[model samples]
Target: MRYFKGVLASERRIRCIEAEIERQQSRLALNGVEGGEQVSRTMEGDAMERGFVKLYDFCDALDTELIGYVEEREAARRTLDCLDDGDMVEVVYLRYFEGLRFPAILKLLNAGGRNMSERKMYSLHEQALCRLWRVIPREHRQRKSVQ
Candidate 1:
């Protein structure tokens, strides 16, 4: 579950990196523009071409990683769906997808004025986890994640 949340964070990081890459590329493009008084030499053009190629390769790699993160997140959500209990599902989903802490989840779960104790909350969490492993099959649990 932690892995699922980490994948989301990695996606945000990839977006930031892509923005930086675009900024760098725009800077490079501005640099490529020849001054009105001067013409671009062959050697200078070649250098600019080489730099853009490297940037293109980097951008392609980042795009691939972003796709991988999206795929992994979907897979984790499917795994979470395997649980039979709605409350259990909510606990796992909120924990992983929303990145909420246990105390926060406890508050959310207790919103109906049920007045659940901390110990009971912990017990519910534990039971949910136990059921999660038993409910999800071996192969599903072994699926690889990019995070």
Candidate 2:
């Protein structure tokens, strides 16, 4: 279950990194525009160089993070695949893969022609997690996260 949660956490981190990259790019764009205020050419060049270097570092970090995220997601997929119960798989998939909250998961399930309550979903989720832990091989259960 922690391993599965780590996948979601990795996704969140990736989004944050991407947002930071965008913010940096916008700052760089703003710096490129000539302003009425006088600024030395050397200072401006140095600032631009620093911005580019920061952007490069962010990109490199993003690439490294993405590779680890992909691996974690793939491992999660395989773990989910090991489950024999359909309902358990769906609940785990919706929670971990789809990143849905319990209420939303219950709503989705009820809408899909299955009658389910929040408590029931919670119970099912716990069972699913336990089953997942049992089904996964001991060596493969080790988590590998970039952060």
lDDT of each: 0.71, 0.82
Largest TM-score belongs to which candidate?
A: 2
**Per-model TM values vs. the true structure:** 0.59, 0.81
Candidate number with greatest lDDT: 2
Identify the runs in model 2 with alpha carbons over 4 angstroms from their true place. 33-41, 137-147
Q: What are the per-residue Cα lDDT tens digits for candidate 2 across 1-147?
A: 666778899999999999999988888879873333344569777787777779889999999999999998997889887778887888899998879988888898899788887888888888887778776657546554897
Candidate 1 per-residue lDDT, tens place, 1-147, comes to: 345556568777787778877776776768764322243558876666666666778788798878887887786778766677777777778777777898998899899776877787777666766666654545444444698
- Candidate 2 matches the true fold with a TM-score of 0.81
Instruction: Please state the error at residue 100 of candidate 2 in Å.
Output: 1.9
Candidate 2 residue 79 C-alpha distance from true site, Å: 0.3
Off by over 4 Å in 1: 1-16, 19-26, 29-51, 107-117, 135-147
